[model samples]
Target: MTSLFVDRRGVVLELESGAIVFRENGERIGTVPIAPLSRVFLRGDVKLPAALLGKLGEQGVGVVILSGRIGRPSLLLARPHNDAVRRVAQIRLSFDEPFCLQIGKTLIERKLTRQIEWFTELRENDMQVRYELSHALRALEEHWPRIGHASSAASLRGVEGSAAARYFSGLQAVVPNSLHFSGRNRRPPRDPFNALLSLTYTLLHSEIAIALYGAGFDPYVGFYHRLAFGRESLASDLLEPLRPLADQFALALIRKKVLEKDHFSTTEAGCLLGKAGRTRYYAAYGEHSETLRKGINQEIEWLTAQVNEIMATAEDDVRSEDDFEDFG
Candidate 1:
């Protein structure tokens, strides 16, 4: 399945027969059969009716809405999979403190390792990139041994956040000099690069959430991230390790000079992707791109398997799964 992005304001999207229709200024601009859409993304001021939403839900299509200039987003997932036993196992694992720490550490370790490798590959050609990324590498390396002794998720998060600061700082250096990027800032990304990062991460987050939900794991519950009302903390936890892929894609665009400075518009709140830029960016990432989507689904399946293994190894620590009450 592929994603459909609606970036123009005053655009009306609806379902007609078995196809999705796009109308602008009271005229039809495009039509796509429902089978082609895996997800629909509405950016800025696009309009859609409840009937179309129902059709999307019936087809199990995910919907994502991005708001304001910074593009903060929320997702509407389809109905959960019918797998009560798996969800029960997922909840049981979330309450396992030691296992949570282990998984969290492993996740951070993977992220740091990938970041180091990602930069190492670029350093041979660009000494300046290597020079800058080396500092961040040292920051990550210094704490590598400590992950084995991480006592709590909160403490592990501290290490992860510190490493991220260094990683992003060095990452910002790798982008084209013409594109502005300064550290990490969100809630209103301060520059074009930050805007790209935030938007990409948002998209990835929604993707992960849907993957987890479809895989029969509770998206709201997680190993590293704590639970909160209406938050998909598990997806957020998995997102930590996967963030580099999003960063890689964003930097690639700038380095390849596919999207120029003119591709973004600066505003008081932050930067926004111009229509031309959005089109170019989506083409590289949009639906039929199974490389990323397949990777994410595999990761989710691996995570679920990891939890099952953890449960077996520590089976004595928790109550038996069979003894748990059935929701039915």
Candidate 2:
């Protein structure tokens, strides 16, 4: 795979002969074989050699230009892949009511459990308040069977939103100063840490969407999240398991004071994270994504082991110890 090269200070990217060259300050530091690289991400105000665009397409390498924030991608250069047939198939499967509901229920339950864990790790004045939050979360879990029976995407979304409201409300009380958590805004985040969290999650969501698209899954047609114009519904569907990861990142930034008020500047529109804020956020986001990737990979490994154990035990006409494990 081609590794991502980020130029904090603007650099020049040029495809020379059989190698990709990254040049800055009259120095050549990085070179990669054209065939091995998948994507080159330009995070700074760098110049791309427009003459090499045709060759980049032929080499199947993507050059993505980011504007303003390191976390946001502005322009992407790559030959688009056509997967209309797979998208149709995935969309059809997404509408399998029973399957979609079950997956949605599992996703929400996992997120809520992690949210509870995060609260327990916070420094709150009233411990009973934490207990109450836990109780509310447990209430949602206990009623999962009922929520699982939601027939439509709209109904399931209501259940998810209700659970999030309870979770975020308890979370808001724990923060030292009020974050002004009125609602979610995409343009700019309202608070410093929130902005970081939003930027990280949006990038995460887009990355996941690209992976899903590459894997031939429909980027539209979701179970819990609503269908909106130009929204990648399927990516939103898959992001549930990772929401807690983003939540934990936000908590760490606030607790460590890595993200200060000065890191954020308020505009007439909303809050905008400064350059320093973006740097801190990108580092934190990288750590969080790695952690979640390992955790989820471990979960999958355990499931695979259980599956093998089950098959072997059944072959021997006996129940294995792993058979007692309830993956769901």
Candidate 3:
């Protein structure tokens, strides 16, 4: 029902009569009922009993461990849906060129549309940045028509990239000059805004992946994003339209000064959010997470219905072919 975030170091977690008790320095710090938890996010040096892991899994509570300075996440997922047929349908659809193209167009169209709306809203409110926002808005609008006309996945991606470039350019105009945010950059995320973007996107991706697994969809098989090793392509596909949401959230953090340049430390590796900053970030995210999850759940439900329809139609087609053969 809710997510629990444990970001402190040296906190030991144990299961006590169906609740999770957090201990630090041999003293009980807190206790949380497991019944209401949908996921747990653990960062840094937190320790948990193995028995708690089993209980969490049994109760369908996903555990996300954010490790290292950059906070790379690893998931201990709950049991996935038992219906393998949905995954089979997903895999089959991935190979369907027309279906893939249509889905790709749909995803990009929705994303660009949201970007256009956001910039348009900002253009009205932020007079100082109107010129730049107008320029980016025009580019996004021009690309909008191209999505409907895209005949292949490669071309669709090209349009999406160009649109994204324009969107970020517009976004750059809104960010404070001190943040030094330009267009989107990642892997190291050279700027503070990009770092926030990367962190939020990572969290969003993990949430969608968990939803996909629960719905019996293979997170690695995708319609818009091609399959790649170690990549959750399906999750990436779902994430496309929702990126504007994450982008907006990140921008809010910077604009409101909840996250600032001082909250980050840069090394050769990349810019990393400091511990205090992360604690604040997690708290802020927890407040916004309910809205994010509602959007994710809506997407998941829509996708589930679409996959079920595809599977039914395929089954019907197979039955028709068998009947024809028997008649002959």
| Stronger candidate by lDDT (1 vs 2) | 1
Q: TM-score of the candidate numbered 2?
A: 0.70
Estimate, for each residue in 1-328, the C-alpha lDDT of model 1 and write its tens digit: 8888888879998889988899999999999888878788888778888888888878888888878665667888876788787889889878889878888988889888878888777776688677787776787688787777778888888888878888878887787767667789887777889878887888888888987887788889988888999888998888887778788788777877877889898888677788898888887778324666776876787797897776666666565665788889
Q: Estimate each model's TM-score.
A: 0.87, 0.70, 0.96
Q: Candidate 2: minimum summed lDDT over ten consecutive residues — where?
A: 298-307
Tens digits of per-residue lDDT for model 2 on 93-203? 466666566667766767767776666665354574666556655755654665667776667778778877666666656554645654344566666556766766766
Winner by lDDT between candidate 3 and candidate 2: 3
Task: Tell me, by lDDT, which candidate is best.
Answer: 3
Q: Which runs of model 2 end up more than 4 angstroms from their true locations? A: 1-10, 16-20, 25-41, 50-88, 121-143, 178-187, 221-223, 294-328
How many clashes show up per model? 1, 1, 0
Better of 1 and 2 by TM-score: 1
Best by TM-score: 3
Badly placed stretches (over 4 Å) of model 3 are 322-328
Q: How does candidate 1 fare on TM-score?
A: 0.87
Candidate 1: residue 178 Cα off by (Å): 3.2
